[model samples]
Target: MSFTVNARKITLSLLIGSSSLMLFACGSSGSDSSAPAPVAPPAPPPATPPSSGASDTNELIKVNQLGFYPASQKIAIVPDNGATEFSVLNSDGVSVLDGELSQANTWDMDGRSVRMADFSALSTSGTYTIEVDGVSASNPFSISSDVYSDAHDTVLKAYYFNRASTALDAQYAGDWQRPTAHPDTQVLVHASAASEQRPEGFVLSSPKGWYDAGDYNKYIVNSGISTYTLLAAYENYSDFYQTRSLNIPESDNALPDIIDEILWNLTWMQTMQDPNDGGVYHKLTTLNFEGAVMPHEATAQRYVVQKSTSAALNFAAVSAQASRIFSSIDSLSALSSELQSAALSAWQWAQQNPDVPYIQPSDVFTGRYDDTNFNDEFSWAAVELFLLTEDTQFLDQYLSLNVPATTPSWPQVGTLGMLSLLNNGKELLSEAQYANVQDKVLGFANQILAEQGNAYQVGMTRSDLIWGSNSNGLNKAIVLLHAAQHTSGDAKPYVDAAVNFVDYVLGRNPTDYSYVTGLGSKPPLDIHHRQSYADNVAAPVPGFVAGGAQPGQQDNCSYPSSQPARSYLDDWCSYSTNEITINWNAPMVYMLAAMESAN
Candidate 1:
């Protein structure tokens, strides 16, 4: 097997010795070193409107509704109803483990005063529930070694559900099969994207990429981060993903399933690049948004809009990064060469036309992923190029800007550069340079933990509950986990905080619902996904992470509350709260794959 061939392996345990992390108390993996001392938790926030009071008695206790990995942290948020202890009961109604609850702490924004119940001491494999003496029992959960395996595959398969330009065969998609849509062999070249070689209305053959979101379109800027995150996961966890098969059309190929799915989009991304000048189109789409209908029914003319510096630099970054990894395998030598050539061409174009932004035409009314700032894009492109070639000029460009790292998103991608560097830059940097890089990474992780004093005890803060807050929470966890993996000393505090953030998205927050569409005790059936709505599937597409709660209420749906964490609406009209996208699911895939590989 080629599982162990890739470079760069780290051997840090996931939160080895936190007070609440005894999932490995009976195990033999003493390979884990001792972790950092626990930070002194801040005083509890005052009980107020945005936070629930001590006397309130609504069902707000939340845990990971799916289950636990048996060798990781296990925690549940319980209401402060004078309960001092909690117990784990087996499915047949027998008590198995008990633990004292932490002091009552009020969440500053989500409106819940709660105590923590950590039953990680229980490692027996069985279905169970957490029960507080005076409060309602929690949703039933299980403890097992293989708790996340199926979820790892299901969430990644969601990419297949979002594919364009091909009919989904019944053998692969089962009931979700549908006809082909948007075969872009005749994509019109818009006037803004025109040149002498290819005038306006040029019919070009550009086909195959996943739909950017619930809307049926392809965007290079959004695809850039989503694709890079998945590739980053593979680069770090190559051993776990080598032979891990996803039963898509290319499952039987010699390449790994993740690479196969990624290639499906990468090929389309390549077509978006113009051979004449190397500028990449920002998006390939119809003039307007389509109505709720099947893929074949909503027939419309598609066009490739204006080329942008953001899209070109993103293309440069992803392609250069991919070329390096593919070159590692002898079988992919040809693809490696081709991707690098495309990347170099894109980099050249970006250098020449460095300020182009996406200007949506007057007639087009689809999603606009416009960004005016290119500092992060430039930094990320330089870093990936440096990694691919080990050129000091590229390294100098990266060092000159000194952009700060944060939780990565489509528009804000400076952190992606830091993550890739942390993974591959150690052997290339001097002693001081590497140390400075490490400090920046760890400093961001420390800031995240220091700011997250809410009752949930996760890594998100009051300002983080914006649109797609779930992705922010998961991306924050990714940062914390990477900090733990790459830093030197006891890594327990960072790892523990990361695990709690994962628990938050899986159903430990104020909403009391698993943010994932499926695979939890309480999941949303009415997601704002066009395919799920038009297909008449009784269940929404499986394994999607919803946008999560925000006070914006942009969709103006019937929301239960106006509080930031409680603004979620699980109906078709609530696009702000319930919509799903590739960028959101990408981090979910990364987190699950990382934890599964760690186990």
Candidate 2:
């Protein structure tokens, strides 16, 4: 049946009854902390006589709450243990600042006090205040100067593990030290901070090649869905941000039109799928300590040992990417029949298998898969599918499915996967679908509100349920809220929460900084294990043949201690540079775009 997928244009106003009051009351009051002076604080009051009974000695003082260490000069403040929570305000009094410990609501679960370890940007130095849970600890501390030095080096020594290469090794050295020739490197050397040196080309080049000879098993690609979707994101990033060109060598001729290239990629994915159960597989030879393959068995995503790589591939990524492909026929008819046939066949397959949709958690082959929560990602995919094919079946499936309760304990992938579905579903579903999703969305949102505390930020891919702090989770929330705004009325809470997080990131003092406390057990946010990102780059180890290392040594592909030379783009981030694919960057780009829009 033909249906219109322009849910974006569908206008359905729900007079959410007064009985629907529960939806409106989302968000916890959180801990009551002393409010700081405005971000733009007024000139200090005349040295007032110590307030009655308020002991000036109870106050504490510090310069800046957060900044690159050694660069930002410290300030001083008088303590006041009279209040319940600590508060920091800007010099002029207005903007709420971040990164203070021993204050109310400062811990992010696990009782680890949150503090500012790095600053990626800069705002004016300001006055600050603090309190330890309702009792004022400090009066005022003013930061006098920036502390980051000229020789500040943020480059991290890391490993670059490659999946195809079947080995673990050290990272390239140039990643930290700039090359003499690159222009950006020169600018970075002179600039006060790495974030400030925005170069034109690959100026942030690093040296130090990785040693990939260690015996280890690499990551396996999930042919069913994740890969295709990631590919689409990869395609979008390449088309919009980096270079608007498509060059496939084997194709001989480059497709000038990006849409065409997208289609080509989509077609290619389908062709690779298992004809029987629709599984996709990729092959890599085994390796040894010397990086030599033993030529035994082929290892892939869960369902391996298949005859070939065909059946393993699915349309996971393509579903999200396909709608963006250019077309005129309401749904284009310009594509070749083979292409159309494959696309339609896949769509049909998805439709027929609605009860057993490609829920990521449903891996019959591998019992050891990650979180078994696929409803969220599936809901998102349904939205995309509906938008592309105008399929109501998909919409109904999505709206009818219940979104699992999300918590700080959930994995990042799980949270984002579900959030993406909530965020994007409205753009393609029918009014019923839209309303149902909106109500459900509100329910999910209320869950977030009900548990919010100043210190309770939902972790994205790690531990702790910190809210609006996770870059990835923020993107998901922002987009879903955007979709909600387009469907329902103002989703300002979601919008505000998202903007606050972005503002927090953007308002930092631009100086040398660090993030030692990672989200979960993976170390700090700044930890640079470069080798994890080089999966696509490394060729099979020279000595490895088929079945790489012995079973026990599969996970030992560690890298070197030194970092590699990097380009301007390379230096922009520590590890993500070498691993420039969709999974990592798509959410990032989406967040950037969203922030830009809000700005």
TM-score on alpha carbons, each prediction: 0.92, 0.44
Candidate 2 lDDT over residue span 1-599, tens digit each: 01011222322231110000111000111111111111221122222222333433422232222332222212222232333233455556553544434332232121212222212122345554443443333334333232211111110011211122222223222222111211111111111111222322212221111121122221112222323333333332332323332222112334423233234334434433334443332211111111122211222211121111112212432433343443422444444333334444544544444333222222121111122234544554454555555668765765565555342111222233334344454455456745654555466565444333433232122111111123334344444443444435655445444433322222211110111111111112222122222233232111110110011111122322111100101121222211121122223333333322222
Please tell me which predicted candidate would have the highest TM-score against the true structure.
Answer: 1
Looking at model 2, how many pairs of residues clash? 132
- Alpha-carbon error at 39 in model 1, in Å? 36
Q: lDDT at 37 for candidate 2? A: 14
Itemize residue pairs with steric clashes in candidate 1.
51-111, 52-111, 52-112
Question: What is the Cα-based TM-score of model 1?
Answer: 0.92
User: All models: lDDT?
Assistant: 0.80, 0.28
- For candidate 2, the per-residue lDDT at 179 reads 17
Off by over 4 Å in 2: 1-103, 108-271, 275-277, 282-317, 320-381, 399-429, 456-476, 483-491, 500-585
